[model samples]
Target chain A: MEIKETFGLMARHTDDVIVVCALGMSANEWWQVTGSEDTFYMHGAMGFASSFALGLAVAMPDKQVWIIDGDGSLCMNLGTLLTASGQGPANLKHFVLNNGVYQTVGGVPMTGASRSSYTAIAAGAGVERCYTADSMNALSAVLADIKKPGHCFIDLQVERDDGPILAPPQPFEGPEMKYRFGRAMERRFGIEVFGPEGY
Target chain B: MSNPTVHDQLVAALKRCDVGLAASLPDDWITPTLQRLDREPGIAHIRVAREAEAVAAASGAFFAGARSVAVMGATGLFTCLGELATLNLRHQIPLFMLVSERGSRDDHRIYQEVQGRRIKPVLESLDFPYFRITSTADIEELPHAYEWCRMQKRPVIGFLARKLLKG
Candidate 1:
């Protein structure tokens, strides 16, 4: 029911794939769950993490890429759905943590929170397959479906947290985040993310 | 040897850079080049919904070990400064942008005047390195420009002037 429970369900599936986390709660919660230096945690540019994942997916066709987005972040850049579906890279998956509130900057309710159907919006945006996971059982089923390769969207409904804080963000950020993630990519994939001089 | 037109030369230049991917959102002056990028065999082209997407997408390509570029109009470039500053500048990620250098006196478009007048000063304030490419010879800077971006670990804009784009 909690967002952490949703993340707990997701943590199992993230081991082999690259995850791009949208800044704020999504970034914080994902780190708390996984403690992964390999995932790219967006510190800013709130709405474009989906776009970042799309580019990574296109570049690394042999690998799977996941975007762990948030409701507010998705609304800010709804057009990403069109770009994702138009490109339709089978290696990518979109997951939105639909908690209906901005949990990080304090629990402010997101606009159109209760009324908007994100799955329908994704479908209209041309995503061929969409799913909604409102419970643990539903989330488990959807996660199983995504294990197979395809471009799919999942709207994850979880309980709202009206707390001063939920989970802390990863300690390393900005330049450190870049180097750590880039180095992890090089080590994991046997590729050169930086030049010989290490620039 | 330079190609006869703007798009031709830009495409050839990208090929020389071994750029494997490109993201673009078009403005009229940059439309042909965007189309040419769409058609390039070696480059995987993405047509994004917004200019910030192009900027973010190119930043994403870095982790894949792929050389990438973004294209947009001057006004479009203006739209993504926050993303550029926060995402790219904060992380010190390299991004190379091919942008329409609008707002020149010869352009004569009143709508573009604001973008032309403000874009450079804004870039200066952000301390982002940019080069104005006004002729075929200036195209040489693009390949080098991108390398400098990677070396500097920041956003670099190659502003394609009206003389280069329209001629």
Candidate 2:
């Protein structure tokens, strides 16, 4: 299925859930699908969205945290797989958008696209539960199990749409994006993301 | 009773700052502190494979309204400069870090000499504020430093000095 469709299906499950998106395709698609300021649309630090989401999950154990990571982004910091698995945060969900190419830079096929089994890699990295959803039906079939209480990794195989695929990203970035997301979290959760004078 | 060691002092300072979480990639100087943090009931510690993972994770905790810190060596700090600039600098996110201040005149490791010479200059160039904590008194000032980082809305490094760690 298309990246947007995968996001569309996952968007339905986002109530009370925190979404962290890797920069580029994952960020743009999730922003286009959700239009929510609350989810952190990371503008940089290419592969560390999973790390960021894991941190968010550990901090707020009461909330569910999911990261929309792409294949390109995942390769940049595969060591994160080890880090996340070691933390073993039950509230966190790892979702890789596997489109077999660097979809943002122009859909050039990545080196290990055919040979790399991300699910197998995740499992080998000590992730307790791993799933693969290659189609809408497959994703629908596994949503319940994947969403259950435990550390889970889901590799979502998405269509490699021709790049320069111009879906707009979340408009605001830098300090504006920070405050937008921080204030939204404070208001939504009644938590203190900033100090009294507002940092 | 014996005086609290530097590790103990630093952990106490973190507690005083209300820091409840830490993500760390250990350097030898900071390993004992990381081990102590691992057992500290009040602080949730995660051992990351790489330095940038710790930075990103600590950044994540900032949004959850919990104070957090990252611990690594000077070399590890060198590895994550891009993440520091792009994520923390770009977003104006506050991250508190404790790192081993390596490559001092007393430090014999030839490999660490480059890190000692370059780390502070690099931090200076980025305008990412950093403070040196060389004694127990300096450790006491950690809460103040942590608050300053939060107020500045950027990443700050508390470099644990070789004198203190080796003492």
Candidate 3:
């Protein structure tokens, strides 16, 4: 499946789920598809979007959290799989866009991309429900199961392209992004993400 | 305050700061504190495989309106510079980290010497602010430090010295 198609499927499935996107292609494509202020588009922190999503899931046990990760980012901090499994937040879903290349960096091949099985690796790391979807039909078939309550992992095997399809960046950056996301959380969940004085 | 143990005092301090969640990786000096956190009733303790996971996890908790902390040794802190810079610094996420002062003169471990000597200079280069806690009295400042971290909107380190942890 193409990368955009995978994102399109995900966008359709996103029903009040707070998304955290890994930096680069995953974040860019997610922004293009959703244009969501509620989602966090990571500007840096190449490998830990999964960890960040894990934190959010653990904090808000009632809310569903999803991480849109990339092959290169996942390889950079594979230990995140173990941590996520250990926490085992029932509200978290980890999704990897596996194109076998760093599309944002001009399509450099990722390390061990062809041979590495992220689903198997996640299963080994103690994630009980792991799936791989290489085509749109396969992905569509698993969409309901992916949204279920549990620590789940999905490897979306997308076709690699030479360059990242340019998309508009997140409208906010740095502290502005923090405030917007935090405020959105507060409004959605009626939680106090910031103090009375707005720190 | 009546606990007399450093671990208990630190844990109590964290509670005073309203920290509901803690993400931690073990360092010998901080192990006692981590153990206490694990057993604490109100705090959600998460044990992570890497220091960066702890850092990023704590950052994530912040957006959920949950006050959180990350605990690790000095060397572990060194391993997470990229995450600290990109995740915490780049996003201006306030993360509170309790790191053991591993390379101090009293620590005496040769392996930790580099972390002791270089960590501060690197933090300086990154323009990250840190505070050193050396005595029981200093534990009281934790709440203030945590609030300051939120106000600053960046990762802040509270360095726990060997002398303090050993007390």
User: How much is the lDDT of residue A52 in candidate 2?
Assistant: 93
Alpha-carbon RMSD of each model = 1.4, 1.0, 1.6
> A41-90 in candidate 2: lDDT tens per residue?
89999999899998999999888898989898899999988998898888
lDDT of 2 by residue, B1-167 (tens): 99877788889999999999999998999999998898799999979999999999999999999899999999999999999999999999999999999887788999999999999999999999988888888988898999999988889999898899987
DockQ of each: 0.88, 0.90, 0.84
| Quality of candidate 1 docking, DockQ | 0.88
Docking class of 2: high
> Which is better, 1 or 2, measured by TM-score?
2
Model 1 residue runs over 4 Å out of place are B1-3
Top-DockQ candidate index: 2
TM-score of each: 0.98, 0.98, 0.96
Window of ten residues with lowest summed lDDT in model 2 chain A? A141-150
What is model 1's interface RMSD?
Answer: 0.6
lDDT of each: 0.90, 0.90, 0.89
* Alpha-carbon runs more than 4 Å astray in model 3: B1-4
